[model samples]
Structure formats: structure tokens, C-alpha cells
Target: MPVLIAIVAVGIVVVVLVVHLTGGSHTAKIANEDAAVERFLIDYPDVEVRQCFLSWDRRDAVLELEDGQVGLVHAVGVNFLTRLVKRGEMTARAGVSDESAVDLETGDVAWPRARMHFADSAMARTVVALFDKKVDTTDNKRAA
Candidate 1:
């Protein structure tokens, strides 16, 4: 029965795929503040990093750079994306999120928005404050 054999083969393939995906989930994370800073500097050299605010799960990060530039790094599946965004490129809100969460709505399509949860409520609000700074709209280029 060819149909019976095909069904068995399909089932085997599905089982293998499921196992592979779930078993390989030591999924990438930023690990710590230094690692987050390292990842961003690797992409955009020549910029000075003043401070870092990372998520509790180590999957998101916010960097304070020289001249008031901001860097965003967040995990997407097993990979991470880093961006040097301008002030108006996104919005951050603390009240709407959980007590320890900071919500960011970045206008970029690749990584439009992210909700980063911190262990401290104060840190969450501080992250939101980073987006509140005022600056010239034309001073910097779009995030890389």
C-alpha cells in the first residue's frame, strides 16, 4: 500500500522537524551588559557607549551612546538585531505596560516594536525616559 507508506514517511518527517526545532532552543540572548555593548559596537564602530539597560530575560537591550544617541538590541527567534535609532524613530511608554515592562514602538519594519521587561519598575520608567529626549530631527541618519 503506497498510500500507507507515504503516510508513515510524512509522520516521521514531522516528528523529526518538531524535535529539531524544540531541542535546539538554547536560543541566543545578550547575556549581560557588556555583551550587549559588544554586539552594538561590533555593528557600529567609532561610537562611545555610556551605559546599558538590559531586559530581565537578557533578550533586549537599550544603550546610551555619546551625543545622546540610542541603541536598541532585541532577540528575534535565535538571532539579535541591533539598531542605532534617533529620538523620533520610536516611542516608549511605561504606564501602559506591566509594572516592570517598557514598551517601545519603533517605526522600523524589520523590528517595529518591542516590549522589554525589567526586574525593577524604576528601570522600566528610565528606559522610557531615554526616548523622551528632544533633538533636531535632521541631525542623525536613520538607525543602522
Candidate 2:
């Protein structure tokens, strides 16, 4: 009984040490625009990154690709989740708690949505605009 108890105690200590050493509490961040671009490119090496913008909390990175395709890099558990989003695929809006934050919904089954917090409302709106789809009024017009 004494030896079993000792072994259990040492095992618990080892587990705790491993977690602490391996950054168990670490929260992933986008770091910067360049970092965000690089991270996105890793999963999509064929595409070129024109520009990138980081959210206020550094939890999200919104990128503009060379072909006008939009991409997103979201921090998840010390890693990044990257996706290429087509125009009009997402709906962006501000969160209830923060005006400087944008909530995005892509209607994707696996990766449905994300939230980005910006430094200001303007930045938030800019992110929202990226996802906005404009109506082509000319297509709906009838020749009288």
C-alpha cells in the first residue's frame, strides 16, 4: 500500500511538470500581420497573400489573397485554423458586448464561424465589409 501510494504521487507530479513545461496554459495569438500571412500560407502555399490584418486580441487574422480571395487564421489551442472564404460566403457584424468586435458566420459545417475584436469600430467595420455582398441592380432590371 505504501509503495503504491508513493508511485501515484510521483506520477501526478510528473504529469503536472509536463503540462507546465509544455505550455498547458498558453493561449495562442496571431502575433502580427506578417505572422498571420505566413501561417495562412503554410496551409495554402499555392496562394499569395496580398495583405493581412490582426484583430485586437490577436485571436484572429483576416487576410487578403492575391486573387482577391479572403482567408482567415484563427488561433485555437496554441495552433492556427486557416480557411479560404469566398466573397459573400460570410456574414459579419459586431458582437453585443463590443462595438470593436466583428462576428463572422460562414455557414460551413466544419468551421462555421469566428469572432474578431479590433482596436476600433472602423476596423471592425472594415472586416465586416470584406464579407458583405453587394446587389447587382443591373442584373435585375427589365427592358421596358
Candidate 3:
């Protein structure tokens, strides 16, 4: 009986987790993307941002530039990126490098790199949808 009860409890927990992960509103997801783009702009004011997609946790972002280059920006948290900016450690030209790699000349900090790692497939789909919507909108405007 105890084993049956434990199995039932585990099943219930799994169901709840699945529902919570998949039940977020579309508007909330778009708002998250907007906030990430805003944060990226604040951190890299000189870079012309064409589009951006943020991780579910908002710890990382993928920025598309006007020049058609895509790059990743990441930090411990949103505020940490600002701190790096203020400390003169971050620049528009800073090349992304592995977390384990060291900058030979700077010697103090590793070169920051931009990369995307989605927490789940749902989040990845949301970003793709957003990108598609943006592209569609741009195309429509160009036709007009």
C-alpha cells in the first residue's frame, strides 16, 4: 500500500510540473522577450538592435543586429550585465569566448560570448514564433 501511494504521489507531481511548464500565456512570453530586448539595448547602446530573443530565465539573450549579425549576451543576471558595462569590461567589440577561456591581453576577465540555450522546447518555439511574426510584419510594411 505504501509503495502504491508513493507512485500515485509521484505521478501527481509530474502532471503538475508539466501543466505549469506549458501553461504560460502568449502575452506573458512576448512581454518577457520585450524586456530582454530592452535590457540588451540598455547594455549595448551603440549596437543597432534589429531583434532579440531572451532565455526563459532572462539570464541570456540572442541579439540580431542591423548589419545581419547575430550574437549572444549573457551574465549572471540582468543587473550583472550593467555592472560589467560600468566597469569598462564590456564593449560592443568584445568577442564571445568560452567560459573556460581567458583573454590573453586583459588577463583579468574572460571574453564574453553570446549564445542561446533554451530551457525547453516550448521556449524555443516561442522565440521562433516571435521571429516569424517580426519577419512577417517587416515584409508587410515593405510591401506597403
Clashes of each: 0, 0, 2
Candidate order by TM-score, highest to lowest?
1, 2, 3
Which order, best to worst by lDDT?
Answer: 1, 2, 3
The lDDT leader among the candidates is: 1
lDDT of 1 by residue, 34-134 (tens): 99999898898888998999899999999988768799888877878888977656898895638789888888786677788998999997788778867
Per-residue lDDT tens digits of candidate 3, residues 1-144? 999999999999998888678763112222465666666667666767676656655566656666444444455421334322211222222113422211112123554344344555555544334323123357668899
Candidate 3 Cα outliers beyond 4 Å, as residue runs: 1-31, 82-115, 119-144
| Global Cα RMSD, each model | 6.3, 5.2, 13.8
Worst 10 residues of 2 by lDDT: 135-144
- By TM-score, the better pick of 1 and 2 is 1
What is the lDDT of every predicted structure here? 0.84, 0.83, 0.48
| lDDT (tens digit, per residue) of candidate 2 on 1-144 | 999999999999999999989898688998789889888889999999877779988989888776667899998888889999877878888778888888898798877877788889888877777666763345348643
Clash pairs detected, candidate 3: 72-114, 96-113
Error of 3 at 129 (Å): 17
